[model samples]
Target: MPYVNIRITREGATSEQKARLIQGATQLLVEVLGKNPQTTVVVIDEVDTDNWGIGGESVTVRRKRGQ
Candidate 1:
């Protein structure tokens, strides 16, 4: 069994993009981990840009700062 957790910023991506991401992730796990698609569990979490940060700066602010 393979468990995948995906965290993404819910800003510009559409529903179709999200679906494709999930499908691709599942496929990768099936191929690389040798997990069965029927038994694999994938979880996608949509996080706000304001709440997600990197290097002590929020993603929204980082984009504005260009760093």
Candidate 2:
């Protein structure tokens, strides 16, 4: 079984978009790694911008500063 975990900031991504992401990731693994799609597990974790950080600053703060 292949497991893939994708984490993105909670920015109002639609269900269709998220489903496409899961499908794409599964396809890539099946094509490149010869993994079985039936046994593949994909999880999407949506995180708050305030909880994600880069360069010692949170994404929420960075967006506010237009960085």
- In model 2, pairs of residues that clash are none
TM-scores of the candidates are 0.83, 0.96
Task: Score each candidate by Cα lDDT.
Answer: 0.85, 0.97
> Tens-digit lDDT track for model 1 on 4-55?
8999887778888878877998899888878788877778888998999988
Cα miss at 7, model 1 (Å)?
Answer: 0.5
Cand. 2 TM to true fold: 0.96
* Residue-level lDDT tens digits of model 2 in 1-67: 9999999999899999999999999999999989999999999999999999999999999999997
User: Candidate 1 lDDT (Cα, whole model)?
Assistant: 0.85
Native-to-model Cα distance after best TM-score fit, residue 30 in candidate 2, in Å = 0.4
lDDT of 2: 0.97
